[model samples]
Target: MKLLLDENLSHRLVGLLAAEFPDSAHPRQLGLRGASDQTIWDYAREHGFAIVSKDNDFRQRVFVEGPPPKVIWLSIGNAGTSAIAALLRSHAPEIRAFARSAQEGLLVIEKAPL
Candidate 1:
């Protein structure tokens, strides 16, 4: 599944995680840097990209509007970009499963305790 990484996430993540999440992109790459959440939401929907973000707004939107572009909400607070990438890489299988499912709208990914 293609992921549209939110502006809050490191744009480098698109390249860092490309092996696993090929075709993933950042807003800056799409000329969407500083774009509003609604614009990002609409872009993801139109482009068939699942939204990946640390923001709760997208999660809230999913609850209220349901899915066409699914959301992967990273709940790992204050983590480094590498840590975030690791978390996403480890959960790649689950993320793919969620994307393929018809009933799921949001997937909340939390950091596992050390």
Candidate 2:
């Protein structure tokens, strides 16, 4: 599953979680650092990348429209890289399942432990 990490997330996350998410990329790396939400959404749709973001805007957009590229909305509170990684570790199975299934929607990840 390719993830297009939104600008709200630190670009460092790309390297930190590279092993787990091989095809992942941050907006900065793709020269899309300051792009608008519409641009980001267009890019993800074009490139077949499911967006991973802390922004709630995408969630609303997804509900109104549908998903061409699915979204992993990190609705959790502010956290360090380690905490985010831990969350991903615990939810790896669910993530994989969601990525593979044709069901396109937002995956809201909460702050508390699973």
Candidate 3:
């Protein structure tokens, strides 16, 4: 699935994700710097991208709007690029399943394994 990495995430993370999800992109790369949450959400919906973000605002919006372009809301806190990459790599299968699954809600990736 295509992904739109939020501005809160490192642009480098996009390149890392490219190894597994080649079609992913960052808002900065897309020239969407400082865009509002709704703008990001609308763009993702229009372009068929699943958003990956640390912000809960996006998750709230999703709950209010349901899914058209799904979301993988990263609930993790203060993580570095490597941490993000490791999580994605280790949980690639689960992530892929969530991306495909018909769950119309936020998918939270916690800061630490529970």
lDDT against the true structure, each candidate: 0.95, 0.83, 0.83
lDDT of 2 by residue, 1-114 (tens): 788888888887777777777778988989998999999999999998888888888877888778977889887778887788777767777888888878757788887866
Could you tell me every candidate's TM-score relative to the true structure? 0.98, 0.91, 0.91
Q: After superposition, how far is residue 70 of candidate 3 from its true place, in Å?
A: 1.3
For candidate 1, write residues 1-114 as lDDT tens digits: 999998999999998999999999999999998999999999999999999999899999999988978999999999999999999999999999998999998999999988
lDDT of 3 by residue, 1-114 (tens): 777888998889878878788789999999999999889999999998889888888888888898866878886788789999888777778778877888655677776766
Off by over 4 Å in 1: none
- CA deviation > 4 Å runs, candidate 3: none
Residue pairs clashing, model 1: none
lDDT of 3 at 77: 80
lDDT of 3 at 19: 78
> Candidate 3 has what TM-score?
0.91
lDDT of 3 at 86: 82
